[model samples]
Target: MTEETNGAAEPKAAAAPSQPVMQVLAQFVRDLSFENIVAQKGITNAAQPDVQVQVNLDAKKRSVENQYEVIMKLKVVSNIKDTQDPMFLMELEYGGIFHIQNVPDEQMHPFLLIECPRMLFPYVRRIVGDVTRDGGFPPLNLETIDFLALYRSELQRRAQAEAAAQTTPAS
Candidate 1:
């Protein structure tokens, strides 16, 4: 047997890359306001008010390196179902500073909008509850939100709006 007959090839070596990293640098309440619109009268009233809540999310890159800020804006309005009188109004803009590294650009948008906010929801919910209770009403414990579903729905809505805008004739 001769060595020339052997067919094995030499293997090449390269450095192992680091995995992706994501961290919550800090979480805080950017803004919060509670209004007892009807004052003492609303609490004394026997009628239970219907509560309406709306949440909006937004994110932006920070001036510092590898850092981004995500804001979860929440609005809550309560009014008597049968009557036009308002009970209370609460608004909160909760925010977080996140440090993201090694994530692909394509995935960054969803990660920031959905994942970041998802991580911060519990704290925001607690604050809302406390604020309502302190304002002399029953605590408004907000339910857990599905950020992924919300993001998808927003995308669909934007697509429909763009399509509608394109179809309408300009005067």
Candidate 2:
């Protein structure tokens, strides 16, 4: 064998396993509430009027290894029955687990806050519709929300307030 072939070859390094990734994740509403605004009688019995529904979206995150859990909180509210009665409030919180290994740091925040909630909104919408319909009132079909716009508006509002406060003389 001719004095040895090519001196000893170097061993090749093993390739690392591919980490998991969040291919798809979604959210939806899981609870609700409804109440008649004016249910009292004797004086002038009035059917439930002045119905108002307010919507709120919230998000939360938890990390496990390279994965994350994103939760969405959706809430709806309406006026009270007799002013002496409690307000009609419906709240639902849903969540999903997402694998986010190797994702860029900058995009993660928006993914958790805005994108996750956006995914969850449709589910939340259907739940609200069903709950209100089941609650004896017509389904309170909600319009789609623009989370990005809302977020930007909130930031702008805060900035304006801060600027105003700074410019104005303190009492």
Considering every candidate listed, which one attains the maximal TM-score? 1
Taking every candidate in turn, the Cα RMSD to the unseen true structure, in Å, is: 3.6, 7.2
- 53 in model 2: Cα distance from truth in Å? 4.2
CA RMSD (A), model 2? 7.2
> Given candidate 2, what's the lDDT at residue 37?
32
lDDT of 1 by residue, 59-129 (tens): 99999998999999999999988886888989999999999998788989999999999999999989998
lDDT of 2 by residue, 1-171 (tens): 566678788787897766535644433334443543323322332335344544444444554465566665555665545553433456666665665665567667666666656766677778778877776566777788787876677668889999999999978
- lDDT of the structure predicted as candidate 1: 0.90
Q: Could you say which candidate leads in lDDT? A: 1
- For candidate 2, the TM-score is 0.59
Q: What is the C-alpha lDDT of each candidate?
A: 0.90, 0.60
lDDT of predicted model 2? 0.60
Residue 64 alpha-carbon offset, candidate 1, angstroms: 1.5
